[model samples]
Target: MLANPALNKLRQQIGCIEETQRRFSRTIPVTEPVDRWLPYGGLSTGCIHEVKGTNLASAIAFSAILASRLAGDQGNILYIAPDRSLYPLGLLSYGINLDQFLHVSTRKSQDLVWTAMEALRCPQVSSVIALLSGLDLTESRRLQLAAEASGVTGFFLGHAASAPIASPITRWKVSSVAGKPGQRFDKPLWTLDLLYCRGGRPGKWTLEWHSQALLPIVPQLPAKQAAREALAG
Candidate 1:
């Protein structure tokens, strides 16, 4: 009898689960919490998410948060950067431990994409972050396939000025936002926008890295300011 592909995949997943359970000796949550703005609660396993930005720092900041969250207590993360060196200090500020992560540098964009796909296929790695200059439909599909095969999460970072719309499970755009000058560090403020999601609506929110926490900035006028305005009117 011919082996059923579905059954084969099920068996593979069961094996993976058993291996992970044995190594960790604990049950980890299946879904990691992203932003409430994200649809589907968080990114699903075996899926590809794209982050686009003109500012490299903004993109890295967003990806770092996802990586740290998915890494959990003992999970491992792999990062492929083709544009520049992965700054340990920046990642530390974002609450990611450089010592606990794998950083791979590639020469070309194509190599970066392929390496990311291969890393995702590795059973030992829980998440893969790929920094690519650009990607077409074919490349995106290939990465998606690898993600599915290994049940790994993939994050693709695209160029800041040019971001082609590829078919990813979720797509986010990060941009600089105005902040109070001289109020604190020289780091720029940023906003994260959910441009496209397979199972959620599109929305935008401001974000700030403060006191080692990635806090979402709620936009609202102060109550005292509103009251004073009302009295003046």
Candidate 2:
């Protein structure tokens, strides 16, 4: 059997191009605790990630926070929702640049998926946040491929109760946490459960949003009468 030299040369060229793309692609830095669990040490740009929560509101907030980071100073974010209920100004509280965000409202489920895939294919779009009830694994894989080709970050925000699909490199579950009695809590707190992560270990932690960062919450010990209570015996 004889091999074609021209075909081998073409394959070698394609391999070089793919290697170059991997070298130049960027990653969006999440918090230390979260990034530590990711194989890339951060959220890789050319991929899809999912955020699920006990309540959709918390999930939206968490995704918005990630979008804010992904947008950086000059990147543009495309936000696609089922309806026009999203208030763009509300994202300001998360340190997002409202001017850099473009919200698209589509009620149709297929349209939502189509719009997200299109937006992800655009190189100018730094990130895309799609609020959906659910999507099949094939649709998710299409979104992932589009993002990978354009070097864009994509997020699927949905309810944690929904049946899990495929294609996301990481899936996070956020559950709101209440403050202690008579305590003054200025930041939003959540119990984050890493539902699954490809090529990384899953973990759970209690974290709070403070000063534009997600920080792990550490329990405090009382001064005098906490010895027996701390021992839990």
Candidate 3:
């Protein structure tokens, strides 16, 4: 018996698709707790993710950490925003390699999105952090596709809790959690809510950001407040 030509062609196509998926599905390693919680050990590259919160500082901090980790020492990372509000020095605490970091500030919102989409398509760019006020499903899908093409990780930092965009692989909502009275100078605390994960369950956690990793901390939320936030998430 001989193999049919059509069957051979179909096998070749399937092999190519599997190879593409394996290439794009490589994940950036994250710390414990969060790492164990994630279906994968860490976030998958070649995908768009969103971080939202009332306190932009906490959200931006988290995004910076992820971007820095994704870019490592040699890869490039682009930060796109309306203004030059994200100080490079501030990101130093997050272990960001300033030499590999670039910030592109645009006055118009549309320009910000356009710049991010272009950056995501750049093979030299390992990650892109875009501060977007709002993004519809269409725009989100475009960014997602761009990342897929270049195997770059993209982060969207949204100001408020906007309508959930469908294209992102995961959506996280963060908020500042007050620490002990005299521990203000200690590590800042934040409540991280995994609002929506494409392949995982939603949950909440208290995390303290250090120079190297995200360590789980004790929850500071009251039972009632925690319940409300959980429901909202």
Candidate 4:
């Protein structure tokens, strides 16, 4: 006798939930304040995360920080940025080891997307970060499935030039914020808004990516301290 279709579908959903729970039981470390809104007190390792590039500076900084933390020093990270203008030397201040990065510098968005999808399917990589312009629902679903299958996390970095694409488990919007005074360059401050989360309430937080006097940015203390240091000098 054939089983009921509706019951079979429900069973499939339940199984997916259980399996996903088991796979994502471990969480990637995030900033303390930001972690509060995340499920399981951290970002899931084997999931797809979205970071929009409305403010290119903040968006890319946010992605780099997490990718560095998650990749640690062992696992490979595939970064597909077709038109990335970032200086590789400066990324070292953010704790990103150049050796662990596999940078895909392409001239076309189509090739970038293809490379990202393929990277996501590879289990050896810990994470795949792609700066893609256009993506349809079907393509997003394929990427999502690939991420799930490999149990490797993915980050889709998009910009306002194209509407948001992909139904990721979590989405974030990062924008630049003013740094304290006496700072020759801003300290990479950003207001992070958690646009959506699968099992958590959305909220916002501010983050300052600590850095030394790296190129494209210079060192400075918090405003008050900087003022005092200046006065003493």
Candidate 5:
């Protein structure tokens, strides 16, 4: 006797549901606080995120925050810098240890994208950051597939004037905010806009460089710290 086609479809659906549940169960929590702003409360392992900005400083700052977060305790970050050099000192100023990060520079944009995909497939790499002059749909799809296979987060950096291609789970646009001129130290201020996201709304928010702790500036400190400072005062 032949099996019923309806039963086969039902079984397939059940199997798919079970596989999705298992995958979600195995997902590791993102180790960085900044990730909370992203959909799913953090960067998903198998997706591509795009960063574009008129302000180079803002773009770099955003990328550094994501990279540092992904590095966590023992993992390493791979940065494919195509146009500008990866400033170790600048990363350190943002409280990121360049020692835990590897910078791979390529002269051409095409090479950078290919290198980024290859690096993402490396099991030892926790995350991959690719600074690209531009990315088309085909390239984005290729990177996305690689990221999914390797369970690595791929960050694509594009110029503000570059044409937008749709492959990113999330797209962000950053801009520089005016800063106080007379301050003792000059720190860059940035505004991050969530241009598009797979499962979230688009909005704009402000962030700054931490002048004291050398970390990405957040709006508020932990509640415990706030309480402690209040009691002290």
Candidate 6:
């Protein structure tokens, strides 16, 4: 006898639930040094994550890269926001595939929550990035549950507001910093703050999200052995 598709899906979801019940769930692998500071040394899945931007552009850029990395090979992204200024060419320049992104807009903020909730529950969807002004803790919790039930990740992107809202698995704040001036194609530097985490302490780091990798932006140092030659010159 053949197994029912619905039944098979339910079994898969059950397995996912078992994984989430553990102290550490699956995370997207990262190669940067900052990985150690993250909850599990990587981006945790099956939970609602918040990314607050100092400005919209940096937020979108930061979130887009993360969404792309999370989606991986076959998953698609559902992005909900009223702002339609998401430039396809720019995203392509940033190494995000244009075809994998689906943009949805809503006039009502309540509709935004509902749409995000539904998207989070779709197994095929890898990530949901919702740009909203405000969301009560109750609504946000529903989204978090949906994410776990579907084994997907959720990112709520918004401007910094007076927040006393739902506790996400992880909360981040990002702001753009000045990059090298004369280099026309220098990647943007960002100040990243770990505002909150489920079981980790909050901290900050400076990183540059290059198109190819997430690199910690560290200061360059002169080689000690070569310093004497520099002084003699």
- TM-score, one value per model: 0.73, 0.81, 0.81, 0.78, 0.72, 0.81
Off by over 4 Å in 4: 1-17, 184-186, 211-233
**How does each model score on lDDT?**
0.72, 0.82, 0.82, 0.77, 0.70, 0.78
Q: For residues 1-233, write the lDDT of model 4, one tens digit per residue.
A: 57999999999999987975666666876776666668778888777888975677556667777888788779888888876686777667677789998888898867877898889999999888888777888888889889888888888887635577768888888877687676534357666778888878897776666553122233447999999989999
Error of 6 at 104 (Å): 0.4
Question: Pairing residues by index, what is the TM-score of model 1?
Answer: 0.73
Model 6's TM-score against the true structure: 0.81
lDDT tens readout by residue for model 5, 151-204: 777777777888765678778888877765764333566777788876667866
Off by over 4 Å in 2: 1-25, 180-186, 220-233
Model 4, residue 30: C-alpha shift (Å): 1.3
| Model 3 per-residue lDDT at 155 | 86
Q: Which ranges of candidate 3 are over 4 A from the true structure? A: 1-24, 182-186, 220-233
Q: Mark the regions of model 1 whose C-alpha exceeds 4 Å error after superposition.
A: 1-36, 181-183, 186-188, 221-233
Q: Which 10 successive residues of model 5 have the least lDDT summed?
A: 23-32
Clash count for each candidate, listed in order shown? 2, 0, 0, 0, 0, 0
Give model 3 RMSD, 1 decimal: 6.1
Question: What is the per-residue lDDT of model 3 for residues 133-174, given as tens digits with 9 covering 90 to 100?
Answer: 677778888889989888989988876556666678888998
Tell me the TM-score of model 2: 0.81
Measured on C-alpha atoms, candidate 6 has an lDDT of 0.78
Candidate 2 or 4, higher TM-score? 2
